[model samples]
Target: MKTAIYEKAGKITVAEIEKPSLQAKDDVIIKVVRACVCGSDLWRYDENVPHEHGDANSGHEAIGIVEEVGEDITTLVPGDFVIVPFTHGCGHCDACRTGFDGTCDNHPGYQNFGNNYQSQYIRFHYGNWALVKVPGQPSDYSEGMIKSLLTLADVMPTGYHAARVADVKPGDKIVVIGDGAVGQCAVIAAKMRGASQIIMMSRHADRQQMALESGATAVVAERGEEGIAKVREILGGGADAALECVGTEASIDQALGVLHNGGRIGFVGVPHYSNHALGSTFSTNIIIGGGAASVTTYVKDFLLDAVLKGQINPGRVFTQTYSLDNIDQAYKDMANRKTIKAMVTVD
Candidate 1:
């Protein structure tokens, strides 16, 4: 099997690695079908955070079919199509019971899964907590569209998490402060949550148009104070809720500045080392919260319905596709912003 490996700091390579097997009773072996490059993956690619000691596998968002299952894995079996949830958590854990699976105690890692035989430091493991099976396909959808289910593994639920955390409501004005896939998805999520007027902030014309297509009622092509002012001018005052999808000091600040005194802000971007101040928000009484989306909690039914119902086509975000052999190009195009999202086909 060829797996993408973080060869060294700021470098990656497709290396021949042994395939993964079921090592736990609740585990299932999946033949990965489609996977996408996430913005967070860029952090590792750029060496912003040291790679986990054994995370040679270059991605977390993926969809596939079950190839095999452990003895106790009764809910799924061979031939079951499933989405691989990015966060690992035991369904019964205290955090999981409260719907926060990203912090699962029994989640798989090198320390818990044991080292791989080929690479003594490599750890690869899967638990029931990381997989969700999709049922019978609806009559109106195609098999190709089914591959888009991979988005539900992370970005779809993540976008919804951003909107939900902000407490966006019907007739409320909202602004999304990113136009990447997650950000565009946030536009769709905000609309689905019943936000009457939604504004998307993006400098790129292509993405601005995409935001409109996704459901944003307006698009602002500015940053900093100028951007906030544009949003305020359009909405009469400030937005009731703001969603931050870009993990940058500029993006976060824009989200805060564009909200009304009692507004709420939801952020799902992976923060860098720079400090993003909340002091200004304090005086405004704005509520702020959001982190790694608890994707596992929402993958069970809600995400499936949104996809099956044709209410949203999050997969349209994948503007470029690459074969597994051309994974390098996928990363290059994404880093250069030439592609909104890159999809890698394993088969």
Candidate 2:
């Protein structure tokens, strides 16, 4: 099998490796059909530390066909096509039952599934609840529809998590802080939740345009206080809610700065900011919420129908595509901002 390896800072390459096999009774071996480079993968690309090279930790977001199923897996079988959420959990765990499957108690840390998704095949554990079954095989859908299904694996659910945590409501004004794939999805989420005004903060023309197409009522290209002021000007005051999709100090500050005194904030970024940056929210009545998205919860509960019905096109955020052989270039283009998001087709 061919797999993606994170060698070190500024280098991600494809290498030939052993194919995964079932190690647990609840495990499943998937033939990866679609996968993509995530923004968090780029963060790892820039890290100076020696990367962990193995099947246990690879690319996270993917949708694939079940080539084999474990003995304990009753709900799924070989030939079932499924969306593999980045996080897996035991279905009966308290966290999983409550829609926070990302923080499942039984499968804490990286113990659940080996998210080696950027490959020809990968192993997935906790099979009963973690995998969301698609209607048919990869050949059943168009290239674009398949891409939209892939987003449900991570980015789309993550974006919707931001809006859900922030409690976005009908007629509310909301500001999205980042313009990455997750941020772009957040715009769609805000609109889906009935937010009347959606302000997307982005400097790039291409991402700004995508934001508009995704449901952003306005765009603010400036950063820092200038951007905050612009968003306020567009909304005619601070917004009712702000969605923080970038996990940097500057982005966090931008989210906080664009909110009303009693507003709420939902953050789904990878959390690079410090506590001091969030301390200012105490003075105002702002409510802060959000964490790693419960991907299975949202997909099963809400967003899947929307995607299948063609009500939203979150897949447009995938501005570029590549083959598994050219995944190295996919990472580079996303890191360089030459593409909004990159998708890899492995069928």
Candidate 3:
């Protein structure tokens, strides 16, 4: 089997390794069809950590066909197409049954599916928890729909999670920080939430255009005080809610700075630095919320209908794609900002 290994910061390589086999009664094997690099992957890249040769299974965003399943895996079988949410969960657990799939109690908490999914075949533990069956067979949709389903594994649902947590509502002014894949989805998510005005803070020319295509009413290409001023000026005061999709002290401050006194702010970016404005949150009545999104449980709400109806193009955020052999290049391009998001066709 071909697998992607996080050998160290700034390096991802394809290596042949032992193929995964069922280790648990509910385990399943997926022939990964499509997988992509995530923004969080860059944290390891930037830290420049020298992970020893062939050390870690790093990717989680993927969708594929079930190649094999344990006898206990009743919800899925060989040939079933499924979306592997970044946050895998026990579908039948109380938290997952409700909607808090991120807090699923039956699986390893907060960690992704064990191996790097950017591979030819990967073992998925607790097949039922890790796999969300596609509404129909893979052939049932257009090529673009398949790409849309890939985003449901993580970025799309994550973006929608920010909106849901912030309680974005109709006619409210909304601002989204960061122009990465999730932030772009935040633009679409806020629009889906019925926000009257969608404001995006982005500097990348290509991503700015994607934001517009995703339904952002306005895009700000400035930063620091200048950018905040521009967005506030556009809003004529402050926004009703802001989604902090970039996990940085600076981005967090910007999100807080551009909100109305009693507004809401939801953040989904994996935190890099502590939010620097705890005082502002204390004084202002900003309703702060957001954590990892439960894509496994909430996919139907944010991605399924939209993809099935062809109403949204979350896949457009995948500006480029590569074969599994080029997994290294895929990660490099995404890490260097040469691509909005990179997808790999694993098969």
Q: Write the per-residue lDDT of candidate 1 for residues 52-124, one digit (tens) a residue.
A: 6457657777777778888877677787777776776677878678776755665633222232211111122
Q: Write the per-residue lDDT of candidate 3 for residues 179-226, one digit (tens) a residue.
A: 999999999899888999998898888988899989999999888889
Error of 3 at 12 (Å): 0.9
Best model per lDDT: 2
Off by over 4 Å in 3: 92-94, 275-280
RMSD of 2: 1.6
Task: Kindly provide the TM-score of model 3 when superposed on the true structure, using C-alpha atoms.
Answer: 0.94
Q: Can you give the TM-score per candidate against the true fold?
A: 0.89, 0.96, 0.94
In angstroms, the error of model 2 at 54 is 4.1
CA deviation > 4 Å runs, candidate 1 = 47-55, 105-126, 136-144, 273-280
Q: After TM-score superposition, what is the CA distance of residue 110 in candidate 3 from its true location, in Å?
A: 3.8
lDDT of each: 0.76, 0.88, 0.84
Clashing pairs in 2: none
